[model samples]
Target chain A: METKGYLDMDLLRFTTAGSVDDGKSTLIGRLMYDTKSIFEDQLEAIERSSEKRGDETVNLALLTDGLKAEREQGITIDVAYRYFATPKRKFIIADTPGHIQYTRNMVTGASTANLAIILIDARNGIIEQTSRHTFIASMLGIKHIVVCVNKMDLVDFSEEVFSAIKKKYQEFSSTLNLADIQYIPISALKGDNVVDASKNMDWYTGKTLLQTLESVQIISDYNFEDARFPVQRVIRPQSAQYPDFRGFAGRVEGGVFRPGDSITVLPSGLTTKISKIYNADVELQEAYSPMSVCITLENNIDISRGDMLVKSDNLPNVEQEVELMVCWMNDKKMNPTGKYLLRHTTNEAKCVVKNIAYKMNINTLEKIVDNFEVEKNDIVKITLKSAKPLFFDSYKRNRGTGSVILVDEFSNETVGAGMIV
Target chain B: MSYNLNHLEQLEAEAIFIFREAVEQFENPVILFSGGKDSITLVHLAYKAFFPAKIPFPLLHIDTGHNFPETLIFRDELAKRYGVKLDVGYVQDSINRGTAVEEKGLNPSRNTLQSITLLEKLEEGKYDAAFGGGRRDEEKARAKERFFSHRDEFGQWDPKNQRPELWNLFNGKKAPGESFRVFPISNWTEMDVWQYIKKENIALPSIYFAHDRNIVNRGGVLLAESPYNTLLPGEKYEQMHIRYRTLGCMTITGAIFSDADNLDKVIEEVAAARSTERGNRADDKRSEAAMEDRKKQGYF
Candidate 1:
């Protein structure tokens, strides 16, 4: 369905990451300010804060980096989300940190992002931080990449420098598992090629940041062909108002769910029919991907949370062994023998790292063979065997069901993010 | 065409997703209901999220003895109506136990002290996760908060070290004694809430609509007359047509000068409002990052 006030178009969640002083915040602030999303009061506050900070001009970076320490240090410490809507599409910008220590935050921010905007300072071109952010974005399996060459103002908006940086980044990015990539040079500080076409850079003709964000084809982003629905909770009131109302409550992770369709609950291997689809009051004929609704079955079956409801034919792999690429997120060293709470779809079971295949050299895009030791922010390929069988396909096939997070038992922190290979 | 899912529907779906994520992740979860519009909306979404089945968890309210008599009544009625368990933590108990000290002044309020009672209650109940109707659009500090907000064992929120929330897949895993303050309606703005209330025909407290109340003008906000609040020197009480942008205690919760009594009117008024809804709340005006500062100390 088309969204209201969004040119009746779909919504997109994307992230921007780069090293410190790369203008990530400036780009986001430019987008919000140019699109008229930043309210008057918010602008006034920023102006006031800028004045208090003894700056003559407003610092656009102050918008996303909200923490006091971050503001003082002039770096993003944690991911800050900023929402803005254009006529074309609604956007949620995950402004992630560029520092090495906050790599886990970048991984977290990019996990759900459909697109990744990796910023490269035009003067410095592609550096170690750029490679790391790009690799992390690629490792997260983000389908689209928008390379923003920021601070073109400092480079006198030179096309040669832009093209050189673009070429260098393209060569480096070629090593990662990226589907689509686009590059644009802009001055986030001067508001060039952000919300409007930059007049200064006539040689480089490309859509503005907002235009790219809105027009980026995301209809194909979600896997609608493969049916996968993880029952989050069960709705059964047994009240006199709606007696005998039993429904499986959850969002459609992937695929379309229609009423009167044959479905099977995974692991249990029970067959049933989707008798009805419900979103609050109305009962619908069909409900598709990303829409949260409750589905009632014609045949009563034993299904609960951590169970999957999918099309009978397009079943997920129900095996104990899974080959995956995981980005370790904890400072505490990963223990291959340690028991991790593996959550895939809704099903969670104990899993152990069976083998460490290799770790990716982000800069080189080479797989370095290593022992099964993954430290913080290290992206490594591994084979995992869970205590219980998992029902899932490759992440490329279904981003919804194929992704997982490993929670450390001792700390209970989400220590690792994994994608099925 | 209404074919486009209304904002309410979108908000509802998002809340349901968050609710399910919390229930599935946390060991013991509770919805913090203050009988306010936001909390009311939260309970409504939580109910629909897991329909037919009883709400998976209980509803907790850290009550200050100084409350709008109506809020407590609404709290009990709602709990009975839904057949969900309700837990009430009292500020008076905390004050009596010397866990929290009561402030004495013309504008004294238990708003800040409620945190102590809340933390104690959460610890006593061993509740690992609490669903709060906290929207980022409500305040400056809240605007920067994560959907699955993490709080340390001391019930402190380190705004600097928040976990990055990516997609719909919420990672609710946290350290011991640390709880996740799940905000299902984090994206819904104040106008969106009123619109949803109007669309869903959700009943709110009587104080939400314009009513003639004996109020005193204090710092550009109308403070309702109550034993909880005293008339300070150079302040005189007078009847004023006022309505509440938010529902809290009679002391700290400020009344806005508005004639828009109905839900649709309220929506329109909110859509065109200048300052934030929390701007009138004096407790937040203490500092630029007062909310953040308080949130760091576990003040929900």
Candidate 2:
């Protein structure tokens, strides 16, 4: 009734990658059910549809397959978001397809995720799909990976099989830049080691999947050493009460900011002190990463949208030429000499592909420099020359200021996504 | 040291960020208001976003001419208090102008006609972006919607061909004639909305609170007896205490039996309720994919 405690919970965003039969939807359904997030009307509607399809059991996939074509094909065509909450944390799941064709979609889903869950079937241990998902997760800079060995009931909850799969996965992913990798044996269909402990596998003493999700250390996931704020808009309330109130409004992309902190404005190199930081009328002493606040400078300086505010001591690279790894998303082949719109942070610039260095072989983690052509679902390294200098950092250092999206001018479609190298 | 924001404060901040983005990118934008709690909350956020100055965008209300009287009163009062411009598009004008025709049945509702009126208004006003208060957690099909949903020249939505929206960087690029429907509170759920309303102390229409009214039962849904609603052969109007979970054309919207007259009681009822807020709408009961079909044809 009075859920006062729900207000204080922190938010956790995660991405899930699994094949069609990996019971990914079933696992999500169980999570919602166990947390009492699924309403009765929705459950009844899914049940009615399941009965019409002549399913032996309630098809949990029906809950997430929102599109008509997706339900007819019985496969996830794109990313679908699902929300649930435990008493400890609020979770947002970006459910993505594991098929090789939908690699772009998986990347799109994993772009904003702090953690990734790679579902593996117990029968097929450490397969190519597992490697492909892990490689993409690492490329996206996901710090946490949870390898869920699903359908353990089919293997009689054998500890040897679990250990073997875990060992093989570790050996394969030892080169990845992941900080935390965990293994959990689960049976989504039978509800084993998902939300509750499994009696069949008493040998496994680790926490359940939900327990791990709720207890993960995510506050340190953000970079708190460098302060970066990309000015989104200028809030000028030209009224009588505050005639000259000009506030720079934006969300803090990294680090912490406080009043009286000396800051440097990029591209113009103007320096000033933060006069005040306001979050809807309440003056905050400090603002950190992901907090949206309006800030006023001590002195009036020339600043506008598409500019960056950073600590004068620690600055980012301000350059006109940038090297990046891009994933082509559009069906049309990329034009080698084509000029497109590159949007990064709050700035948009006209950019052209300078050179195609190499294309990554996702399956083998090999770099092929012979091919210069870029097509759909192809990840390639390219150098770009922008019309104006962009303030950015490496994608590995901070995801907020390091990512860019390319838009086709003619079609106005987002055709490519790039991470600055 | 780092400080964490509460859930309500976080949602509020995210919504304000989206509002500022809409104003900065689009040449002409308007807020699609329905005098409901969600839109009211949006208006409040807009006020906070550009404080000391009026909201840069105008409020667009598609009037079906079959709404509750209290809703209209509240809409006018809110516009005056906030000093924001209000634009009303009438469905009856479309009907009289031969642009839209009424359905022939025992219970004919103007719910579907709002789409035509909305499109006509957008074309007439040359609005490049329209802000809606639609949330993803409201219905099944909406769960896949992006923050910036693209619309064709004809105002039709192609769900399969939507652009991939990643991170906070929304791709709002579009052709000249094509427009975008931006949802600021797309991530918020029903519970989140209620909690925000309580925390912000935003005013809502009186119809949301419990009151005595005349009602008639139709296919297990309690319909508020209004002038536009025609009773069936065996149905009769009876006095009952009820409140609306959602607001729309009076002919199609259903009221729930509740005793939650205050905000606290309403929150408790919402927390314990089993059905979704949209479960009581008679328009959605027309088909399983009613919302999806309507969304494709450019209905908010």
Among all candidates shown, the one with the greatest TM-score:
2
The residue-by-residue lDDT of candidate 2 on A1-421, one tens digit each, is 2365766777788999998788898888887877788888889889988998899989877888888888788898888888877767778888888898888999999998989999999988878888889999999999899999999999989999999999999999999878899999999888888899989999999999999999898878788878999998888878888899999999899889999999999889999999999887789999887888899999999899999999999999999999999999999889988899999999999999999999998888899988878998899999999999999999999999999999999999999999999
TM-score of each: 0.91, 0.98
Question: Against the true two-chain complex, what DockQ does each candidate achieve?
Answer: 0.36, 0.64
What 10-residue stretch in candidate 1 chain B is worst by lDDT?
B1-10
> Candidate 1 docking category?
acceptable
For the predicted complex of model 2, DockQ is 0.64
lDDT tens string, model 2, B177-252?
9999999998888888987898878899999999999999888788888889898888899999999889998888
Question: Candidate 2 deviates by what RMSD?
Answer: 1.4
For candidate 1, give the lDDT of residue A358.
Answer: 90
| lDDT (tens digit, per residue) of candidate 1 on B62-158 | 8888788878888888999878999999999999999999887656788899889999999999999889998876775676787788898898998
Candidate 2 positional error at A66, Å: 0.5
Highest DockQ scorer: 2
| i-RMS for every candidate | 4.4, 1.7
Error of 2 at A51 (Å): 1.7
